[model samples]
Target: MPIHGIGIDILHVPRLAALIERRGLSKLASRILSPVELDAFCSLTSQSENKRALAANERGPTEPIVRFLGVRWTVKEAAYKALYPLRPTWKELTYTSFDAKKGLKPELVYASLSPDTTPAKLHVSASHDGEHIVATVLVEQG
Candidate 1:
């Protein structure tokens, strides 16, 4: 019924690029992604035409790895914010999808699990400012 916890995070794009270069996207994806998430990531990452269009507009690269990782990080932060109030295990919350409404904002969708209660509602908002990615998460219980 009431809001429990709120989490907000900002990620530097250069930092993400460095992580992808050092650890590789596959490993990061496996560690942080669910099957459905993987599918969505793949869909968003694999779309070259879309990437090119975004790139033409001076957005982030057309490569899916960059977009996918960006989305994954946003979801991770959002899930963290949403689940902290419940104090569930880290693995209990799973990210489902990360997408944008247009070319301007980022969105996150996730599922939270616990034996005693049903999944709570997680509201995620994300954006990019060329230099950094920003996300805000809100958690509520009913």
Candidate 2:
């Protein structure tokens, strides 16, 4: 297969945190996360609700959730670059990985926008350090 396009994106963790601070976590999640991703995000955050003392209005997302949002944002941005003009909506794509012990490799689950987009291969890679997250996407034709 030949490479069709490649894109890379980087984001600062605190930048996303600041955004979430201005616009609630749930609101941000719904705008960026696919339905499956929304469910997963909710499940992850709801775990600590019982232990949290501050009301939802006063609390910001935990570090882990911030990191999660960072990854999603950067990866989606990268994918958008790779698939430019084809333009799959945020809800039309999801991310999945397998075997975290072996270093999970990110995969893009894209609902093809058209018949021409099908049978395409998408390779996604993402990583987050203390204050930054980056993702790269490569698109290939069969």
Candidate 3:
């Protein structure tokens, strides 16, 4: 196995907030999140709605959704960069909790489409700042 590529991306939280305000959360999320990711995204959004109805969270009513979108956007973008020539659509890549791992893992649903190259491993890390999120992806090809 050899290292295929590495990618890093940083996103401002407010940019995602603006996107939500303009396009709405569901619309943007559906376009970016795979089915498994979408389920968790839906749960996050649904909870935000309920929280808003009761009272806005101190951070803000849309805080949770904005953070969710920001993290996903950056992670997917980084993954796309790491994949290089073999571009994968947002819906084709997903991140979710698997096994008893400490954090989530990435899955390339379209991996089968590329018969020659197999992603032996995908090392991912994501972090959030006050109003920014960053993600890094390390790709190993087998």
Using lDDT, give the best candidate's number.
Answer: 2
Give per-residue CA lDDT, model 1, range 1-142, as digits (tens): 7986678878877787777667866576666676666676667655754645544224434444675567557657766766664564333445444436545433344444545665666777767767677777777764
Local accuracy by lDDT, each model: 0.61, 0.83, 0.74
Weakest lDDT window of 10 consecutive positions for candidate 2: 48-57
Leading candidate by TM-score: 2
- Clash pairs, candidate 3, are none
Candidate 2: what lDDT?
0.83
Ranking by TM-score: 2, 3, 1
Q: Per-residue lDDT for 1-142 in model 2, tens only? A: 8887898999988889889988988999999999888988887788656567545766677887788778889988999898776788888879864458988766887876577666558899998888989999998865
Name every residue pair that clashes in candidate 2: none
| Better candidate number, 1 or 3, judged by TM-score | 3
Across residues 1-142, which tens digit of lDDT does each residue of candidate 3 receive? 6888888999988877877767866688889888888999878877877766634334443766777778878987988898787777788777653435666354433343456655557778888889989988888876
Question: Model 2 residue 95 lDDT?
Answer: 81
TM-score of candidate 1 against the unseen true structure: 0.69
